[model samples]
Target chain A: MNMVVCIKQVPDSAQIRVHPVTNTIMRQGVPTIINPYDLHALEAAMALRDRLGGTVTVLTMGPPMAATALRKALGHGADRGILLSDRFFAGADTLATSYALTSAIQKIGESRPVDIVFTGKQTIDGDTAQVGPGIARRMGLNQLTYVSAIPTIDQEAGEITVHRRAEGGVQVLKTKLPCLITMLEATNVLRRGSLPDMLRAERAEVETWNAEAAGVEDIGKCGMKGSPTKVSKVFAPSPRAEKAKMVEGDTAEAKARVAIDALAETDPQLLSVIARQPALAS
Target chain B: KSKELPEHLKAYKNVWVFVELEHGRVHPVSWELLTEGRKLAAALNVDLAGVVLGPSGEGTDSAVAEAFHYGADRVYLVEDPLLENYRTDPFTKAMTDLVNTHKPEVLLLGASTLGRDLAGAVATTLATGLTADCTELAIDPNRNMAATRPTFGGSLLCTIMTQQARPQMATVRPRVMAMGEPDRSRSGEVVRERLDMVEEDIVTKVLDFIPDADSNQAQLAFADIVVAGGLGLQKPENIKLVKDLAAVLGAEYGCSRPLIQKGWMTADRQIGQTGKTIRPRLYIAAGISGAIQHRVGSEGADQILAINIDPNAPIFDFAHHGIVGDALEILPALTEAFRQRLAVDRLAG
Candidate 1:
């Protein structure tokens, strides 16, 4: 039961600061971390490997510096690490991103067929949740997204049952192996790597693959050229001219009443909604 | 199919908003889009059109009439019972067919669960660019659709443009746009279009429409005053602090999307990108880190007072007021303060 988890290096959103002059995010000094959601997916993969007695390979696509993120993955108990880095892969949108990743996964599969591939439901930056499905489509693998729990995996039988979060409720679905699973957050807690694991991760040699090396031939469809969507512009939300009408109430109680009155004046339904809740009011 | 400028659709000249209807009732986001569409139309100096696809019935006709009141200059009514329940395949076909026949410069759809799903498929089918979860939209001087949304989780904003694409498309989150004033006297021309597409060709089936539970309905989109919490609350149980404050102020309660991801609360109570957009009068953000994703969702609030231990938190950058304090201590203090003030006000009144 060999599992491969694909993770991304994302700027610590908490530490990101906007450049006041250029109106661009200041990315120079911000330290990158494994996308918070991908951590859960990595943990899920590692836990499965631990339980089923198999190898876990961590894969990432980014600049050369992204090796740091892969090392972090290795420190978390992955048996192997692979970095898919190339200038051609830069500025790739979800479509091209999935293409490059799927190509690398195929090259990896040449050595040992990957039983499962794991990714977060979406990246914090892209927030599209489309890459996982895109990869599944490109590789002809079963796509399971918004997965909350993996109940069982029958390796020989090539079957897996998972609890998938649908629009309104959970759908307990079953699918064959060799599938891509995007785990929802909080599905599993991440484990801290031991000192020995950190030492090994620090010393381990990570394999890097360029576009041609990863078996990608169509350079046009491999990066920005393959991406159909383009971002034209981004700007700050315009501020409204009118300031908030602060109530005249002096005390907290007075302010509360004023707030309630103001809210009721605007929409009485708000009061009804609150009154309906017993715990809300004394 | 991927080629440019179908001879038939060359003359369509305006922006259109697809008014999504469910259970014979129009979604409120449609009206909201009308207000937004009206602005873009004026900017482009073109007519704003509402394209409603459904069966020919009173509901459909009423929606057309309602569209005029909301500022649409004309309504394109596609009458077909097959369109009653939203199946992605049929809806996409119906919409694309209309676009191909009557070329609109821009298309706006609500970024609802259904809208996102349909927009992606339709944009791919048309091979046109589409932006999702747009918090703002404007027709540039060049007549391109400029869709603005937060990037990197709302730490910064980015505006996306679909260059050289006909029928430029964008999906806006619910409540991010204001609803237009209803004018009962206003009327618009309604052109009924024929839907030749059949239901059998559709691949997905509408198993059921599980309406939201009464208790679970936060109505955050319609909330006037929202008090939301975030991971800063430390413990999931501290969410009750926000609930208590909301209870006193007669406001709805919501949390940042991380709280939902953390399983601290259900999706209904979550507020942010991928959660809910709220335009409340007074928003009390307790312990919220104000990530760009969450900021985009709540930035529309009229008054935002951020309470967090870290004054330097991003929440304060946009917050109208800020208090560097522990939310746990501040929440109870604020709640008790509100309780007493409100009691005194009721007596005075």
Candidate 2:
């Protein structure tokens, strides 16, 4: 199996802060981490490589600095890393993003017949879980999204069975190989690479591909120009003016009472809730 | 190659919200979108319509009738059992057919699991742009549907526009928009549409739906009050403090997406981007370093109280009130405080 995992570099949301006067995120100095969700996807791919006897390649489309994420993927047991960086790829939405990625995958496929493509369920920055599906649609890869478990793999039969997170339920689906999968969080635990893996990753030369090198023919379809959607503005939501009625009391029991009383007046439906559920009262 | 619409095709107007039904029950998110769509429709000075696709029969009629009561001026109904199980192939075909036949300026769907799935497929089929999980939607002065949603994982808000697209599309998370009162006497014109595609063409089959276990499911969407903790809780065991606080406040307990990602909290109890959208009376965010993704999910809360040791936390920007304190210390304090206050109030009453 020639497995490919896509990763993204994002600002650590924990340390991300907004300027008081500007009301915009102070992104300049904040450190970036390989998106936590993508780490799970990379880990899953590496595990499959180790178990099935295959090579794992990590791919990313971002600024040149995103090579750091590729290095991190290499450090975590990936065999090779490719960075698709170009000025034309900036400000691409999910559709345009999928185009660039699909074109790059096609380029990579020229060298190796790709068996599986892995992506996080969604990126923290994009938050739209559409790219995985978008890429699958473009590449005609069988998309298995929100996948919780890769229960079994029939290598000889060229098929894989997975547990998917559907609405209000789970769906167990079996599909053929050469598919795109977006792994749900916590599906598999990421493994720590040995000292040799870390040392090799630090010294490994990552291959870079520009749009032309990635087989992107129409530059218009690779970035913001190809994206039909445009973000017009972003602003802080209007703050609520009313203050919370701070309730004070001595004992935990008494405090519960005050809070419940406020709940009764503010959200009166809660009073009936307390009346109905005795477990809540005590 | 002119992709521009002919003058005749450009006459289509108004905004439409697809009233989604599953297993014979109308999803509550439909009503929420109706309330939101009504506002957008009024602002755009166009009729607010609903497109209902289900098995042709009593249930379909009732769903369309309910749409009128919820402020839709008209309801487009397509009755077919093939539409029964919310299949992507049939639903997408039905919706796109409606859009092609009677074009709407803006289309809205609830950002539920079903809505997200259907919206993406349908939008792609139509080759139209779609903004998913929009926290806010409004008509710009140009009458374009301006969809404001969180971007960069909810660290920032991005207003997206689908230029040159006839039907601007967006999906809103459930509970983020308020549902208006149902005026049962309200009436609307209902048009029955036909499905030309047969069931055989649909490739994917729904073998079965294993319902979520009761223990694993959290009714966070409809919970009136939510108490959620973030990394500030310090240890996984400290999550008990969140449950205790929620108990005193009569609120459901959840956590930021990280806690869920970290396996510190159940998937259902995660409250942020990719988790659940909650619009509670009060949302007490403790130790949560509100990322744009998390903030977008909870920004709809009527009252947001943020408690964090670092006053510089982004959660404070949208929080109704901010307490510069340690969550581990303040949580116990607040829990104890609420517990006592509630007891005295009950005694006084």
Q: Considering every candidate listed, which one attains the maximal DockQ?
A: 2
Candidate 2 at residue A274, lDDT? 36
DockQ of 2: 0.30
Give model 1's DockQ, 2 decimals. Answer: 0.19
Give the TM-score of candidate 2 (chain A): 0.91
- Over A218-248, each residue of candidate 1 has an lDDT whose tens digit, in order, gives 8886666766567655445554454334444
- Residue by residue across B26-96, what tens digits does model 2's lDDT show? 88999999999999889988899999999877777888889999999999999888887765567877998
Q: Rate the local accuracy (lDDT) of all candidates.
A: 0.76, 0.79
DockQ for the candidates, in order: 0.19, 0.30
Model number with the top lDDT: 2
Count of steric clashes across candidates, in order: 16, 26
TM-score (0 to 1) of chain B for each candidate: 0.90, 0.90
User: With candidate 2 superimposed using the best TM-score fit, by how many Å does residue B171's alpha carbon deviate from the native?
Assistant: 1.8
lDDT of 1 by residue, B1-349 (tens): 2435455445657989989776677888889999999999999889999989888788888888898999999998888988876655567678888888778888998866556556655665565667767777887665667888666766556777765456788887778899978999999888877878775654334443445455556777777678889888989888888988887777888898778878887778888776778888678888888776787778888767777778578777777666666778778877886667556655655
Q: What's the alpha carbon RMSD for model 1? A: 6.0
